[model samples]
Target chain A: MTTQQEFTDYQIDALKELANIGMGRAGAKLSQVFEHRVTLNVPNVAMVDEDKFNSLALKFETGSPIVNIIQQSFIGEIEGRSAFIIGGHNFADLVNILGYEEYDAIDEGHQKEMLMDISNAVNSACLSGLAEQLELDIELTNPSIAAFNTPNSALKDFFFKQKHQETHQTLLFEIKFFIKDINLYCDNIISLKISSLENLRNALERLL
Target chain B: MVNEEQFTEFSKLLQELSSIGFIILDRRMNVIFWNRFMELHSHIKSEEILSRKLTSFFPDVNEAWLNKKIRSTLVLNNQAVTSWEHRPYLLKLPSTQYSIDDVDFMYQNCSYFPVKDSDNSTIAVGIAIYDVTEIAVSQKLLENVTEQALDLQEISTHDHLTGLFNRKFFLDQLVQDASRCRRLNWGLGIAMIDADHFKSINDTYGHQTGDDVLKELAERLQATLRTFDSLCRYGGEEFALILPNTTEQQTRQVCERLRECVDKAPIISAGREIPVTVSIGISFLSRNKSLEEIISEADAALYLAKHNGRNRVEQHQAE
Candidate 1:
């Protein structure tokens, strides 16, 4: 549960607006690259209390079965950890949708690599507001599998352990991106430090 | 020596003496720097290779793939890694280790790191390749041993002559199939098959002819049974079968069919035509019954079939 006092309604609204803009940019970039129709929806933003950090992890995985959580850290004007939570009824279905041959698609490792490829494309375009940080290279860590086929309790414990002592407050956003043509549906979750959220709010307000 | 000159010389020595290979490539796939390790393995010196398009002379380098990896590294401003299993090597070099039949070239795990300019824009990609032939060889050997172990396991559970399930495997499946039938509320039929007048055949013909008759009989009976039916060589001139999902009625039809199949033809063995027939006994799986009781019932039925006639099917009567 998020404490209502940490962020005003206006600030939360600004974060959602910022996410919508980022989603638009991501959809455009992906459609241009893949030559497929893409649909993106606005994300939900909430200020998570340090006490509720464990519960926050379960919220990200509410609609998910066992999924692969790919983590990529970004640092710049506004920094946060981005995640691609990919799970489906059948991974072979996803492999077919991605157009991998039967010789390669049936393998487990290749399936994970497929997740990484699509996740990287979305993370680069949507998360961290990467376009604004052009002058300097934003140190985006290579995507790593933070957890694989993990249960909710373990995932929550992982999220709790990743919380650093210096972090004052955390903001969580749940976003969805869909490729309409092939039904490539995926959910993304990102968390930003309160200070970075402040910087992002100021930036979005200037645009407003 | 001056301090700066000594530092420069030490850096040069480290790059040249390293066991792994290293190369730097600009955005246009032009060679920027080739370390001593690369030069020694590739046998191309600095002068001839510097600033030259790597793909121009090196046919081993996959130009299209190398560019894709480099482009991803540059665009994402992140590291790109490849395992030897996924791709054996980008630049093939002859194996320096002791000769192995399957391994003639070095296996490599390569990493591409983005090299940035003063303004933090990626201008080049630095690639590091490590030799992993030893690891690959060990993994292959391990796989071969595992496959051999599986083959050994296969041999232990089959009859040496007929290649059918042996007595031990038949017992294992009997218990498992009974429990499964009880759990699923289905019927289970057990049959004991004995070739009639088998001792006379062995005494009349040679032992080899007798063996040939058994082999041919096994093949004929096997073809007549359903795929789910399990047949095993119980002992000399005798067989046991576990027929799952078969009621008493279906069991009679199946056993009668097997009896008719063997009765129809005389098996030709070693230039001799030997007439053969089999006596079959049947029992049904009952609720809350032990496997021993079911098998004993089937055995009693076989004894009855031998008493009444030589080539017929008999069912144990319920007491």
Candidate 2:
């Protein structure tokens, strides 16, 4: 695992630039799907240990009436996972924009499937954009709902149980997208396996 | 990347074997691939559907919205998803499932996916359709059952003969209304009414005439009270009225109206016109008064109305 000291300012800047490009594409695609202008802004990226992921997950703990998470894993030159989390109220807002009647006929399972479709859209767009820009190829598995909670308090324990080996660092990106007109909000998180960090760094070097 | 022939072969296989409906549209929204499931559901084979605009076949589809969804998949390279809850059905295909007969059209959840070539440019967009009629039908049935249960509960709380609140329900309401009146410092009045000479009328005429007299008396008593008042069949030839937010003078006036209403009308049953009269005993709610105490006062007042004279109104005199 590489420390923060090993990566120069230029390498971090390059990675941030890649996030901007990829997230920009994701934001645009999201805007089209919802028929509303969506804005995505990521201020910083953190490289930390796997244990810290539990803490990083706190921001996504909206404590809403319902919480749904969709996580998809990708493998190729760089291997990692992307998760999309949305609060129930925000999801209801999204459902309204999608032209669904309020609480009419959708069950929990169908709601999860609908959310997974949206997750697949954003994850594939962002990852594909990053891959295309870095000239690397990554194949993604089918998106699936990873977690569902009504009270949202159980989400922290859910993340804590997914601890990995002690040898790797996790690259965590906390990003949010907004559909301002409808007052809709959602969070997207991308975490890369520590073993893939070197390969990602090598790809960044090749681009530089 | 697969060659053109290989891709075409794959598309044909997808059209042939998949149970779910699948359709592929080019940038112009022209149908390039229509699968077997689509043919079986939509009744349009690929030979006729190929190279045709999707809108021509299903004009009910919101063109502007569909164009935006397809544009996102084609240009932005992301999938667009919609469920049956939103639009119900995209193609308006008839429901083929035997489990659900009430629904005329199939419920669909559609996902539009981008198809890319070697250069990574999106050449076409594919829609994956899933039938969700079972879920929709089940939810509908559950709501219907809840409604039926509510109707049954109403039947259980009402009297079959007079179509008024039953004795048990009135007693339950008495406790709740009495407590509310005490807390809010509002006046509550209870009146016990009995049909005068009801037994002699049954013997002189018949039990059917007696039933008619009771039914007419209940209707007149209900009509004399306000909509918020509670009317219940207390027992044989006896009925009760619970009035909230009423004073002693108001209760007397209402009781007088009830007596006049029954005395003025003659209930006709089986070609016989029989006069009907009611004696009413009234009592008002007071501070620290229990439900049993209020009922006893009303019953004593009713006895006084019978003793003083038949077919009259009497108020409980607190001693």
Candidate 3:
């Protein structure tokens, strides 16, 4: 088994560089779609478990149901997952940007389809960049969704199962990016285990 | 191992290993070849249901419909498929194991495909059942959240009385527009308006007529202002306008037009012809001033216009 401390420093550095590049691409795409200037910022990154992830997501305190696109992949020996979260407050702006009159009578199937499309585009762009940098052929699964209505504890239950199984800690990288007129927020997170570091190092050496 | 009894046992094991449920029925609709899954799901033992007419085993099954579908499949020499939208047959499943109240069993999406022989004749109907309860529940939850969000938004952004943008929304727009102007160096104008002696109109003709007066004023303001300009109910008997890319002089002309428009028509409210007029105060963003300071100056100018005389426009002159 890979140790948690052995992977922390390297993963943090790799995540920052990866987010800087990936979010830049996402920002450009959103700017073109919304026809406005967009600002992408990566203020911080950290490796956290389920408890910390839940507490951190709650601090944002958005009024609407949190819409997230989760894309999973296996990079080397590590499991990689990236999620792009859009808060409820930004729903109308997104709807208007997509050329809808109003979100008054939006149906569930339509919302799911839209979420799936957005998640697919953003995750493909960002994760593909990460894979390119790490020099790994990462296989990605179809995106899935999760939502939170109130500040309920159940928000973290789904992600906790993986954290509890392994003694070796996972790498959790948090990135925040935004575009101006559209108010696009790309909260991208990448996670992986320590055993995958050797393959990642070999890939990086090959790239160099 | 090669004895006749052992050969028969091996054939039974081979029949049970298949994933697809295989059921053989004679022309008289006698049940035969019920697999393990079919027995478990339908709660009908092979020994008990064998040689019994399929319709007799499950009394709810429509014999006429089944006969018609079977005939069609045999004539066409192709496998006939039926979707969940069309109910194919009612199976005698264990009621305790699959309750109607259970979401999974409540909405079963099953497909019925006909099994055909080499000679292109219908042999049996294979039923494939899938549970889509989770997808349906998730879809409903998403709809509920969206509907609740829209309801909350409508309550927050609109004025209860006149259906205009409320004062809170107007302030928010002022702040947003101010920031945009600061960045782009664009000009913006703010107009403060008060209905001339609105209190006496309410006292004389009653509050109902007063409400009609407010609604009429809102409609006229909407008509007179440009589409880009936002007119909001600032408070009781007062309204405000936020005009982007408009200088003080241009805003003054807009205000003058609005003033004349209101004075020319006597508002007809609840069968009462009420003569109404309004005082207007205009202010534009100074190069260094914040939105709040500009609004205060506009309010001061409105005070000046009301003091001098009602029904006229006054431009704010910062000291």
Candidate 4:
């Protein structure tokens, strides 16, 4: 749990358990928020290096589908960011969910705003669920679109933003949410500050 | 040197007097504080807005979404920023920008900050709104100007009546294509077409009817040509065609199709059907032939077509 030490398997497993329980509540919240049936994926928890992060991103974006990313930082006992990546394929259906009567190209400004609103809801619910389990007081900052109508190449830029954090390694949580009826899906990348995450070593020991 | 209470009063005075919009709301988003600028722009006095929910005055707001943003700011204990690019404005106050257009709503950049009580629990939220309508309007004007400039540039190169490339553009394009064809050892076809008895028709029916007939003939020539063919309004009563990668045989076949179309049907002008036929001159790009020589060859063949019969097609044969 130390800044220099890598995450042990037990910690990763404990975090995965924490994520699944949190996402269960988040999926229900999302279903109500979007008025669509939401399905959650079994969360993937890993400590990633630069090379592993790129390959991991490529695995999620097969055929390099265009995507938009909205990211927000969480503060308090748990510090880091969550980037919710909405795929391009989901846009036509997402327009209806956002209450747009007809999708016009000029409505790009409004479309991005609604997308940010949706992702902000998603990030807050997931992070609060994890923070509550850790007994960590957290505050999520405003969400912003990190990239729009772009390739997943921005995924690298998302990772590098954590360079300012005082941690040698990065803890990443990958969660995929699906609205099957609308054929809409969003992949989430949640990275918590390593130092803040390691602070839970004592609590995780007893909990695990 | 102000005391603590005096300093609080002084800050309160400053907040009310500040130019930017400032509002304070309790947990339910009811207006707790409304500054002078908010009153002036919103037309709602502080006394009127206070204790009222923010959405009551601005009914267009999505209250459900606004509540979600406020709750996140409270739990996260952070200020959330909204840009004009994303939502334009949260509260649609009237714009202050001076313009020829009608009065439009103001574009705003807003922020939401959580206020905590003595016990450290979030008690209220503060919002700050900045007017950015002038910036938004200027950006929109720039986009429109750029589009108009592109349209003007396109108009300069096309014939107004036929919507085809003008004679100047045709001459420039032919020179380039002719040189490229010779360098690549490919053949380029050049054909000149003219409506027979165009002047007599203009004299009898009037210039307007002549225009209608010319436009009709241009449409027929365009339809009979291949996708790669480039048609131009070469003169007052004349049209030209440039066919890429075409040989002598292909050129003759294309000329026949263009000629047959106008010869087959009478051109209908203003619902009046008038019989019409065209004469065409066909020539192909050859080795060691200058562009001027090729053009002159086509012109001479056109004269021959007029001499043979007014409504026939003719090929330019090398001496």
Best by DockQ: 4
Candidate ordering by TM-score (highest first)? 4, 2, 1, 3
Score candidate 1 by lDDT. 0.76
Tens-digit per-residue lDDT, B1-319, candidate 1: 4576887796587567659788889989999878888888778887899999988867866565466556656655556566666567778887777767668888887878888765898899998889899998898799999999988877597898988899999999998988898889999999999999999999999888889988988999899998989999999999999999899999999999999999998999877789999999999999866899989999999999999987999999998
Worst 10 residues of 3 chain A by lDDT: A147-156
Judging by TM-score against the true structure, name the best candidate: 4
List the candidate 1 regions with Cα displacement exceeding 4 Å: A1-5, A20-42, A47-112, A124-171, A178-183, A191-208, B1-17, B56-64, B99-101, B139-168, B171-319
- Candidate 1 versus the native: TM-score? 0.52
What are the candidates' individual DockQ scores? 0.06, 0.10, 0.01, 0.13
lDDT scores of the candidates, listed in order = 0.76, 0.78, 0.65, 0.78
Each candidate structure's TM-score, on Cα atoms with residue i matched to residue i, is 0.52, 0.54, 0.36, 0.57
lDDT of 3 at B177: 82
- Between candidates 2 and 4, the one scoring higher on TM-score is 4
Candidate 2 local lDDT, A1-208, one digit each (tens): 2465556778877888887887787777667666788887665577766556766766663447567777888899898887787776565664554444456225665466557656776677678777887778887776767776555765665566544544446676677766778766777777777778778888889989
Chain B structural similarity as TM-score, candidate 3: 0.52
Q: Which residue pairs show collisions in model 1?
A: none
- Write candidate 3's Cα lDDT for B189-222 as tens digits: 9999999999999999999999999999998888
Clashing pairs in 4: A139-B76
